[model samples]
Target: MDNLQRIDYLLHTNALDEMGKNELISILLDEYGSKIVRLAYIYVKDQGKAEDIAQEVFLKCYEKLDQYRQEASIETWLSKIAINICRDYLRSGWFKYFARGVIDTFPYLKHKETPELKLIEQMENEKLMQAVFSLPQKYREVIILHYYMEYSTKQIGDLLAIKSVSVRSRLARAREKLQKKLETGEGS
Candidate 1:
């Protein structure tokens, strides 16, 4: 069976010892840790906070494994948890006070034929990310999931508990806003 199917079987069997459970959790972390962290980073905009949120996502997964419905892929389920945790973090007073002073960008490592080309690409990416970040939460999230995560509108709608039409609308609005922001060099 595939890894996801295997995970489903193990979760449903009620046959895991502590060691088995840890192994399962480890497998899950290995599979989805970076994905969860990246999703959280799009929301919270800090690598450290994103990593913490990923840990929380896995802890929640372990605690609630029995509640998994198998209606979606494990990655989708983990993403939902990470998004919820990031939302909570974003809404916290602590985040408001401390996060304001922190300007952490995702480290991008790439090899280019020329240093000038690398600098140009990096600056463009940073501008795009800044534009995305300046969007309202609703628009930003749809943009992130649709473009960054490469999820379909239907999948994004399912994850966000919204209509696919809503996802499309948000995506269009977000693109428009991003285009405007990029052209104007706003929020850079």
Candidate 2:
């Protein structure tokens, strides 16, 4: 069974013992941890803080698993939770005066290639990430979700709790800003 199906079965069967929790959390973190960190990084820009946010996302998920309505896919639900946590961090006072520059962009977590191929992929990813990190958070997130995460505008809207039209407008503006930055070599 899929993770969601397994989770649902566990909850329904009242089999949420230690083994079950471990298995569920393992599957979840294995499946979504890097995505959560990367998504959070799009907001906070600090890889360390993004990793913390990812852990918090999963913690909150486990706490609230019983309340999951399944209106969205498990990945979507986890992403929404991650987005909210990252947004909260961005709005917090700690991030205002203490924000650090982007230290490291999240590395791709899934490994499906030879060592040489992975190295080449990481090298390519590094160049693009520099430009992406320079964007304003509002524009950055829309760009990240659309291009990096490959979420549809409607899916992004749902995850961010915004209208799809708003997502499209933000994406348009982000693309314009990104192009200008790439051309000028400055985050204008």
Candidate 3:
């Protein structure tokens, strides 16, 4: 059987032995590593730390696989796990390590392109992302979920365990913060 079939079987039968579990994890990591790592990096802003966080997320998923109820798509469940892991990591004060000198060390800021338009677009996108990242955690989480992950307010509220009104408030605050950053050419 193909990998997806194996994973589906393991999940449905709830009979995944250690080896089956390991194989499932291997398949997920192979398929989703880059996307998970990128999302973590966007949250934490450090490549190394992001990779570590992604690995931790997968570990958590493996440990909790038996609890998954298939209420949502597997990808959504995994993303919810990843986002929670990132939020917990942010709450742990580790982000300070990444925040230090990040502006100076930002790789995207150093890029050069021969095409002036493309370069401008890249710079603008980088600036916007930086601004988003600089928002307060409450605002940042909503914005990232809404924009980066394309989650609706209701979905975000459900994932974050907040009311939809709270999500809307946070999203509004985030947009206000982003606008201020763009207008003032300042992050944070």
Candidate 4:
């Protein structure tokens, strides 16, 4: 079994004590911490807020362990929780009052051999990121979850509490919007 599957198995089949459950949570964090943070960042665009959202996601996971239905993978469940938390934060008055577009801090690209190539790639990536972030929230989430996180349409639907058809439609629309933005240098 994969790590998440194994974690799911242990969580359900074994009667882990408090310490064991904590250990499992630690493992989950190790496996998905950066990922969860990145996912949150895509929504909030703030590294600190994203980190906070990730912490909240894990805490919810720990509290809701017994409630998991296992119809979806543990990662999916965690992602759903994280998304919900992000939505909540987005709707908060605090976020509305203080929000500013922060450049993505994480380096998502690989280092190339030449400095020139690396610089070129970085600028391209920054432009692309800006374009993606400029999308409406619905489209942006679909793009990030589909392309960046590699979630299937059905999986994304489950996480977003929408139908798979909706996810596919959003993906198509998001791609079109992205294409226009990139070609026109809209967000540059």
**Would you estimate the TM-scores of all the predictions?**
0.82, 0.72, 0.74, 0.81
- Residue 145 lDDT in candidate 4: 93
Query: Please, what is the whole-model Cα lDDT of each candidate in the order they appear?
Result: 0.79, 0.75, 0.76, 0.82
Lowest summed lDDT across 10 adjacent residues in model 1 is found at: 103-112
The local distance difference test score of model 2 is 0.75
Q: Model 4, 143: alpha-carbon shift in Å?
A: 0.4
Tens-place lDDT per residue, model 4, 40-141, is 876876667789999999999998887888899888998999999999998998767645322223243222234333543564587887788789999999
Q: Taking the tens digit of each residue's C-alpha lDDT, what string does model 2 give over 1-188?
A: 88767766765676666777677778889878887887776676556678899999999988887687778777899999998888888788776654432212323322324443354356546445656767887788888788778999999998888899999999998878777877887742
Candidate 4 stretches greater than 4 Å from native: 1-6, 101-124
The sequence of per-residue lDDT tens digits that candidate 3 reaches over residues 151-171 is 889888877788999999888
Residue 98 displacement in candidate 4 (angstroms): 1.6
Better of 3 and 4 by TM-score: 4
Clashes of each: 0, 0, 0, 0
Better of 1 and 2 by lDDT: 1
Off by over 4 Å in 1: 12-20, 102-124
Superposed Cα deviation of residue 106, candidate 3 (Å):
11
Candidate 3 residues lying further than 4 Å off, grouped into runs, are 1-6, 93-124
TM-score of candidate 2 relative to the true fold: 0.72
> Which residue pairs in model 2 clash with each other?
none
Candidate 1, clashing residue pairs? Answer: none
Q: After superposition, how far is residue 174 of candidate 3 from its true place, in Å?
A: 2.0
